[model samples]
Target: MDDNKNLFKQIQALYRGLFAFVVAFALIGVGLIAYMNNPQLFTSDITASETEYVPIPEDDSDKIEDGVHVRTGFVEADGLMETVNNCTNCHSSELVLQNRMSKENWIATIRWMQETQNLWDLGGNEEIIVAYLVKNYPVIKKGRRGALTDIEWYDL
Candidate 1:
């Protein structure tokens, strides 16, 4: 009876140690992921080289029908453009420009970032981003030329 009781206690102790170790490991893993996904905490050390290309502003006065300003250069629309504050903190504007998505998808992506990736809120800027994405990144439609004409093929 004594040996059985001792064996049971040893088994319980082993399980307790294992449980503690697992909990500690899980906590550390969560911490590491949170740190890595937190854009506010992460930063890039890369610098642009002299050979790197920079986009030059274009003159829009000639393009516009009226005296009103039109978007002819990148900087002209920069104010109205939606920027993911957290995303651009470590990434470049080109990165944002290259990626495009619908308004719904953008909202979902932002939510995912907020829930799991530790992305910060944009406050009033959220509307600006959503509007910009909807206006500029609308879904693509099929071209008229792609559809086959009735006279193009004869019935076999």
Candidate 2:
């Protein structure tokens, strides 16, 4: 009878240890889950602000290359020149210079900007802008053996 009581006590003690281990493991798991779900709440001293960088305009005169006529800019055509001036009034000239688009695409983008983004009507300047973008910013083709072969694909 005494041995039976000792055996029962051992079993009870084992069960209690197992229960405590299980409770500790569950608490650790809950802690991990909470940390993952709310990382900012667990962390100390951090904040963020949304910001955008705008490019500064470059002087057109400085961009004139050698052998180019003084009267004409990179886009010497009167129509294109007029478009560049009109478009760059709101945005930087660099934005206009960096983007390459087909004539149709450029017209559609301009129209969208005007209709939705409060961009003013081009007022006869659309033709000049379209021509300039088409001429200078033609769709680039890949896999050509030219001076650009050494340049990185992303850079082009």
Each candidate structure's count of clashing pairs: 0, 0
**Per-residue accuracy of model 1 over 71-154 as CA lDDT, tens digit each:** 322232333434534445545656556656788987887787788867778787877776666666556765665756666666
TM-score of 1: 0.38
Model 1, position 104: C-alpha lDDT score: 91
Model 1 whole-model lDDT (C-alpha atoms): 0.64
Worst 10 residues of 1 by lDDT: 67-76
True lDDT of residue 130, candidate 1: 68
Kindly report which residue stretches of model 2 are placed more than 4 angstroms away from their true locations once superposed: 1-74, 144-156
lDDT per residue for candidate 2 within 22-92, as digits (tens), equals: 99999999999998997765666444323455688766652435633243334554465576557766776
Least accurate 10 contiguous residues by lDDT in model 2: 67-76
lDDT of 1 at 118: 79
User: By lDDT, who's the top model here?
Assistant: 2
- Candidate 2: which pairs clash? none
TM-score of each: 0.38, 0.44
